[model samples]
Target: MSYPICHEEIIEDRDVTAQLDPRGDVAVLVPAAGAGVRLGPGRPKALRLLGGEPLLVHAVRRLAAAASVHTVVVAAPAADLVAVRELLAPVAPVTVVAGGVQRQASVAAALAAVPAGPEIVLVHDAARALTPPGLVESVAAAVRSGHDAVIPVLPVVDTIKEIGVGERVLGTVDRSALRAVQTPQGFRRGVLTTAHAAATDPLTDDAGLVEKLGVPVVCVPGSEHALKITRPFDLALAEHLLAMGR
Candidate 1:
């Protein structure tokens, strides 16, 4: 007969204080070069305030806090590199590199900067400042399990529809098969290098380029806490969330 296992029993069986994986020697790249054009006039997107600090700081801190991450590479503009270094230099094993106009370019720049390639390379947007610590651990664990690429995704809870340029409803989209992709996308170093090289131009996300390589990227459950701080309203909400320690 099968017996039920309690939480404490499971931990004891695993022979650990926590159920975290032993492999965490992952490299994390935080792309922070985008000029806040979409976010309005001045300042870069990474410098945008969220929860009383630059959004980039929060992103860096989260990755630095992860036991699985051995190094963090921040790609940003040369002009901002000095200031960013001053802000995050205390975070050990951190390096800042000049980025490019496109997201792919920035990633390439960061990749070039890493001396020793890690088993898993996680690419995350500095805009996603509030990513949960547990979520970060989950993606790293998934990659360590032999998956080439792992992305955190959220199932669409609201009914979705395809719309045209003129705001006309084009058609109803199948929400069942759709999930809104979130960041902290983990990839094997070799897999990402080949995929990024194959991609000649800018695409929406790294997964797009990876998908073109015919390798499927596995998705893990994500949380609302990992929301990307895109606009002014998002900044306000992030502050609220941070205050409540959510």
Candidate 2:
């Protein structure tokens, strides 16, 4: 329909900077396939109790409660899949599937399970039961804002050292540019898929795969509260932290 626009045309063109804001669906991937060798014979690392509940249960609940997250998926081990399914069935709508041998493979399996089309995906360690919801939200927000990937990291506070075999210190390492990375690591679905697809070797973290793709991964401040439970001492420390409400 052609309309008539006959009026005093005042064209005031100023640089209206529009902030790049992108929003789309999100999925949280929790790799629960590990046998918890460090934690000993158990359902999995995810099923280990951190404070009062299972570690995985806590992560799933937090993800479900997060405003930016839409779905939660667990790539679990064949031996522990049934237990994880039963334990987390009531907390949130989770899809439990068999995971692969390595962490990268597990994450890839989870990504494969994610529904097609563009989406924001977060790969978090289920062992990190106490990971703050804020961390998840922040990373997810960054991914939603058109970032290929986002990671939460903390500056290495302890004195760095380049140690060799048998606890021998090779030299003093620089801590200034070093950071200890943490999870709830978020990524755009396409980027994650491509990164995983191109991956040849097993990576310690998913972001390593992204780095191979040569994408600049955005980093956000991490929290001490979001510690990964690895050793017996770590478990004790987590208990202490929870008790102190830190």
Candidate 3:
């Protein structure tokens, strides 16, 4: 039998909490440098407002609520590190570093800032600002339980298609084996560092790089609340979700 994640699970921080592995001292790295063109430009993606506050503020606050999360390192837009730092200070104690043009580069920058003691590191997305602290701890716990890499995922619900060209669908794809992967992807610090070191191509997500290293990646259940805020519609929906205290 499993219990639902509720407000009572929240710790000393504002609105969230998590169950943690005693051995997993965790550091979270957020790559927030992306210019979300799909979000219609104006502000950097992570700096974009949700529920009247920057996404970074919400994300950091939720992350710090986890008992085992010892540090948060955010790779912010190189030009706005000071402002980003200022905005998030009231939310959580974070180390802000200058981010890079590409997502992978920003992750590398944040990884460098992670302190020495944490045995596990999680690479999270700032766009997934509403991720539950339970999911965060679940990934960390998996890493501590001897998994080299861990990711939270939801089963793919929509029918899939394989398109060739010119908007043509070549064949129907299988959804049963597919998953919509979410972030705060956890990794052993050594494995993550090695994966980054060997990375040659730039993939959007960190798990792909780990897969390239022949490291096995494990999956855990994710939350519906952990939606990635991308478009204008997503932002509006997220506001509603937050307002209702979902």
Best by TM-score: 3
What TM-score goes with each of the models?
A: 0.89, 0.85, 0.91
Worst 10 residues of 1 by lDDT: 4-13
Candidate 1 per-residue lDDT, tens place, 124-203, comes to 99998878666777778878889888888777779888899999999998876777777899888999999988997689
lDDT of each: 0.79, 0.77, 0.84
- As for lDDT, the candidate ahead, 1 or 2, is 1
Clashing residue pairs for model 1: 24-68
Model 2 Cα lDDT, one tens digit per residue, 1-246: 211111222112221112213233678899988877887776567777878888788778877766666678899887777878898889988889899888988998888888765388999998887776666777777677778888887777799888899999999888766677888898988898899899998989988888888887877767677889987778888788768764
- Among all windows of ten consecutive residues in candidate 3, which has the lowest summed lDDT? 2-11
lDDT of 2 at 215: 85
TM-score order of candidates, best first? 3, 1, 2
Per-residue CA lDDT of model 3 for 81-186, tens digit only, reads 8999889888888999999999999999999999889979999999999887877887788788898888887778899999988999999988777777888899
Q: What lDDT score is found at residue 70 in candidate 1? A: 81
Model 2's TM-score against the true structure: 0.85
